[model samples]
Target: MIGKRVLSQEPVTLAEVKELTEAREKEGELTYEQTLTMDYCNKFAKLDKKKAEELIAEVEGLEKLSRRHAISLSDLLPSNADEIKLLFSKEHFVLSDEEISKLLDIVGKYKG
Candidate 1:
């Protein structure tokens, strides 16, 4: 197929990627790039399967948050509002203290 441009947007998690990669590898279903990416994520993902899933669930449930930002929160797991604010610095948006506190509380739950 020929195309001028394609715009794609989707939300995904490292845990999901790992699971898919494992399945693909078992079935001999992936390309070289996919295999390499999966290997790297398995080695470097910040949270393990369980914690990552939990955080993704909690963060995505927040109305003010995007799935992408939720993934970042799962990855960084910031402890303070200041830290979270820094994560959001590139956005043309700001969160209230209460909102920041709520997000931090969710992040703290699985930190240990």
Candidate 2:
């Protein structure tokens, strides 16, 4: 682990995590933490990689949402306005009713 440095940091959805871990597994054995992460992603990832990417892209198009929010939305696909609000609870700004409806509609499209 010596001399390891993070070149950059970015948010990733569970589906992306699953994709990466699966690739690592195919190459060789995963470390213990990676195995645990793979298990978690397998159990909770709601969408596959392609769908997740699409969802992230669409979500990112909305105003006031960051890449982190897009990834979180794509990963959880919150069912209702309340759930969506819960996801954004820590943010300084609040989502309007219109925005919440928009988010729900987009999420519903992907859920199907």
Candidate 3:
């Protein structure tokens, strides 16, 4: 008989982010969010709550989903591959085609 195993990864929670920033500030060191965003364009990559909320709102606006755009409650219906392609193509986002395919598949499976 083979043994069973489970794996888990830590999520990037808001509390962890606060602790890291406080620790670095105490040492007069730059925070990870600061360092990462110093050379970046959008502030969403900061990983802070305020910025994260703003980004969420912006992305929701772009996706044209409902104000209550919970992933679980989203209208995941792809309608067709062409609509999926158009929805993804309109954004200057960085996601692989494979990822898009998977999203489309999830929506199709759920709503079709």
State which candidate has the highest TM-score. 2
> Per-prediction TM-score, please?
0.72, 0.95, 0.29
* Per-residue accuracy of model 2 over 1-112 as CA lDDT, tens digit each: 8999999998888998999999999999999999999999989999998998888899889999988999999989999999999999999999999999999999999998
Q: Quick one: how many clashes does candidate 3 have? A: 0
Query: How does candidate 1 score on lDDT?
Result: 0.83
In candidate 3, what are the lDDT values of residues 2-47, reduced to their tens digit?
Answer: 7965577543324235556556667896757655633342322224
User: After superposition, which runs of candidate 1 have C-alpha atoms over 4 Å from their true positions?
Assistant: 1-8, 48-50
Q: What RMSD, rounded to one decimal, does every model reach?
A: 3.3, 0.9, 13.3
For lDDT, candidate 1 versus 2, the one ahead is: 2
When sorted by lDDT, best at the front, the candidate numbers are: 2, 1, 3
Best by lDDT: 2
Which residue runs of candidate 3 sit more than 4 Å off their true CA positions? 1-73
Candidate 1, run of 10 with poorest lDDT? 1-10
At residue 97, candidate 3 shows an lDDT of 62
User: For candidate 1, what is the TM-score?
Assistant: 0.72
TM-score quality measure for candidate 2: 0.95
Q: After superposition, how far is residue 49 of candidate 1 from its true place, in Å?
A: 4.6
